[model samples]
Target: MPYAKLTITVPDAVWIGELSRAYPETRFRVLAATADVATGVARIEITGEEPEAISEDIRDYDTVTDLTVFESDERMRRVQVETTVPLLMTSLQNSGVPLEMPFEVCDGEMAFEATIPQQNLSKFGETLDGMGISYRVDRIQQDVESDPLLTDRQEWLLDEAIERGYYDTPRRTTLVDLADELDIAKSTCSEILHRAEERVLKDYMGDEKGARPTVAVSSD
Candidate 1:
């Protein structure tokens, strides 16, 4: 499957955009969003320099007729906010893309990273267009390696490695550091990394003859 990271900006005419503009200084990270036939709610984890002010502002928002805190600390606060933006979530959910974690909402844009079929890419875009939402594709990963070449665990580790700057020129972390972070032995981490690299290189160089790629489902 191919994966893409997209950032969608809601128009100012929309309720969510209005709220975002109202609270320009507050950062709202949507943890989860769900909708029913008539109503929708979004669990937002908010964090900013001024927790008290941010909390007050959220309470003042008319759109969030109901708001309740889940947790609060010095740096971050979580809350369930009744939203008028459930339609946006529903649109994406029905777009035939398997949403991955780490969904984000900050400023006036919602950022989503998901695994999608290459063929459905156009359909996904069309869905957004049908909803009148503006968006941009931040990144895309096409299948350069054979399917199942790396186990889910291996793929996760690779993602972590790239995120933590392990592949940087100066190297943000050593293999030992990565192992410590993963709570695994350095040797095991090394083995997994080496094997993953070998498989990826072989596939990229077209050395794996008779390799078959998985067909992805259409967005429709």
Candidate 2:
């Protein structure tokens, strides 16, 4: 038997059914999958061998789209924590606070800035007791990442626009309206938006080289 990996970008609603039928007797693994309701983009990865043949006792699949080969060294893996600030806050409140001090999560691996006095740290640490969370206030500021999309000029523009009430939650103005306000053409504005989006993904996600799947024909 020969193996292949299929990186299928399709609708999540139909993926499970298709997968079951496609590899009925074959042992397979779902390496990764992402379903975003907002974008309706579902990225799925599955790897398995051909337990049954689809051609004249030859190649595993008759169509090329059904196969994607990968080198042995290629891999995908990561570690992540899933929790929101609101949930964390609710958990915190459920624990108990010894004082009335304002603080922020700072949203990074290490370090934080404190407007409140340093004494508040121990009190907060005590509050974190039953919550199973660890936190601290540090005097040093560390390096962190900004959005991958924003250039200095682009970030400056977004900040200024937000400050000027351009893209409010209530939808103040359209992109064309903002373009006119910035004295740039609509097409130029669209181009900037496209470039900025692509740059952010490329910079942050890294350029993922496409894997070409393998096909094998075998006969006893």
Candidate 3:
């Protein structure tokens, strides 16, 4: 829930080993040590949830001096943990939260999240229910609006088109139908709507153009 910074004196060698073994996830970097290098104070920034949430690690550092914790639980929660992948699509195909593989090992210190489209979320939920799997949807489909390139008018037109099922496989609404409803020329509507649609799909595809850059590591 919050990041905590703890100040404490480094205990004896035995205690140090015990603390390390005890808190596997707690990172203990040496901010500074004693002049003799045995009884110096150190700052231990625990990067995780609240102290109570992750209290098991806190207990080990009972002897830490100037014991203080500084962090904002609210500020931590405000961070938008946006995911680049289509979570629901992946969940449906994979059948669950695949925490491994390309999902990759995340930093224990960082916030975690998943973003899924509304339709995919609903489908995934129904699948889970059908399979008798116990799960809950904690969030809603974040409606990502079309990019800045589209004017407000064009964005509204495109959104209405999608809502009216104009993009459906069966062609739920024809260009003539939309024109009649909006009392506008089909050509003008089509151009605006197409531009809006392109922007939305572009953002969804992770980029409007070109491939993501690759990193090449040198042996040196």
In terms of TM-score, the best-performing candidate is: 1
The most accurate candidate by lDDT is: 1
Question: How high is the CA lDDT of each candidate model?
Answer: 0.76, 0.39, 0.45
Off-target runs (Cα >4 Å) in candidate 2 are 1-149, 164-168, 201-220
Which clashing pairs does model 1 show?
Answer: none
TM-score per prediction, in order, is 0.60, 0.24, 0.28
Q: Which regions of candidate 1 deviate over 4 angstroms?
A: 13-15, 145-220
Candidate number that wins on TM-score, 1 or 2: 1
- Tens digit per residue, CA lDDT, model 2, 167-202: 678877778887898898888777776676577667
lDDT of 1 by residue, 1-220 (tens): 7888888886765555656666666677777777754467877777766655576666775555788888998768888777554667677766766655446666788777777687677788998899898999999987565559888878888888988889999999999999999899999999999888888888776854456575789999
Please give the clash total of every predicted structure, in order.
0, 3, 1
Residue 159 alpha-carbon offset, candidate 1, angstroms: 17
Q: Which residue ranges in model 3 land beyond 4 Å of their true spot?
A: 1-149, 205-220
Per-residue lDDT over 1-220 for candidate 3, one digit per residue giving the tens place of the 0 to 100 score: 1111211122223333344445545443323222222232333334344433333343344443333444435212111111122222233354332221112111221112344444544564565466443443334434565447678798788878888889899989999899779889989888887778787787767662456676789999
Model 2 lowest lDDT segment of ten: 1-10
